[model samples]
Target: MPALGGKIDMVPGRMHGLRVQAQREGRYRGQCAEYCGEQHARMALEVVARPPDAFDAWLAAQAGPAAAPANAQLARGQAVFLAQRCQACHAVRGVTAGGPGATLGPDLTHVGSRRTIAAGTLPTHAATLAGWVADPQAHKAGARMPATRTLDGADLRALAAWLESLQ
Candidate 1:
């Protein structure tokens, strides 16, 4: 498919679906394609175009349980994440976070598999993820996420690494 441009006009009460196929394994970046709401500009899309086998493998991984932290640092990070109530908004299926109400935010079951985070506000990297986790409001205005100033740098790094390892 040709490159898709942002700024898609909305058709009220309509559900549109566009199907496209990727020929390679890579991350495809796009935008909302329509002005849906106030945050439309920040609404971005990241489609991971993986080969069939790789896609299946990723699917299997997502279907399975969230991996346990390999080291003490990651374990600490996970603990911090849970303690901070991050699970209240986001979800990492297979991992027992909060219940259904905790699923208010994004489904992070395969977040590490994506190319971007915060609806494409930042790249899916350790540094960016750490910053996002630290101060999401700074990056996106009127964001529901609150700043995690209580989490020190070390804990932030460990949490970021743990999130990145989700892939």
Candidate 2:
């Protein structure tokens, strides 16, 4: 408490749930009050507070498949994805299929539309995505996603761009 000057407070352990009355339609963020691991500070949670009608529409859009690649670069990225081991861990609906190991990682169907990645460790951008894909361990210490060091810079950018375009 003294180190923080009492400005910061934390409660460790699992949270049962949360309830809030959103006064306006906008995004609100929350982070874990409990200690998780080395990357605790990077962890983040989001609550998109909106009217019921807008919320319903948002849910529908989120439930839909990832958007198709709209250009040559995106298409190339898609092709690179199909040729990689990414399907073994992650899945991009309509682009990647699930198998025995598909459930190992999170379903990245709408990752592009999300604000953060690596459990909110980094912002959702092409550069960050590429960095994560290249070496997740550098960002998240215990990440299960392996490094894609083999991908050349151009290919990596293409892949990241394609992922960002999934929105």
Candidate 3:
């Protein structure tokens, strides 16, 4: 997602480029303008434009380990994440050693910093995160993360909260 006035496209076996200025410091949301396929709706994008200093700080934070859990609930959530083998497909950088999930799935090192989830299909909030954790396909059909039928309501909330605090 480019700034309000920016746009770009990709073509098979071709190269292209476009330059656009970030008119303001904030987040911009956009979606593919062309018909891609059955799951085109899931092809969402977001652009976060920040001042040079802020951007640098953000980048530095991302390069470091995820923030530690601050509460008991969040701690439990972390446990659930590891016990459920979420590390098999997701990584929290310093929290989890490098593995397949580190490359295969979106990195969760700073997931809480994101403004949206499920490829922008839903807002980033604890409740939505919980739902997504329970059943990813429900939010984004054909998602790689299978529905988690083992977690109860409390555990789900804790897990989601933990992820939300990863920033």
Which candidate gets the maximum TM-score versus the true structure?
Answer: 3
lDDT at 137 for candidate 3?
81
Candidate 1 structure lDDT:
0.76
- Give the runs in model 2 whose Cα sits over 4 Å from its true position: 1-21
How high is each candidate's TM-score?
A: 0.79, 0.81, 0.85
Please say which candidate is ahead in TM-score: 1 or 2: 2
- Tens digits of per-residue lDDT for model 2 on 39-84? 6776666667789998899899989998999999999998898898
Show model 3 residue runs off by greater than 4 Å: 1-19
lDDT per residue (tens digit) for residues 84-164 in model 3: 888888888778877645667888889987888878888887888898888888888877777998898888899999988
Model 1 agreement with the true structure over 24-122: per-residue lDDT tens digits: 677777766555666677987766777789889878877876778889987887787788788888887766546866767887666776677888788
Give the clashing pairs for model 1.
Answer: 8-33, 8-34
Instruction: Give the CA lDDT, 0 to 100, for residue 1 in model 3.
Output: 62
Number of clashes found in candidate 3? 1
Using lDDT as the measure, name the better of candidate 2 and candidate 3. Answer: 3
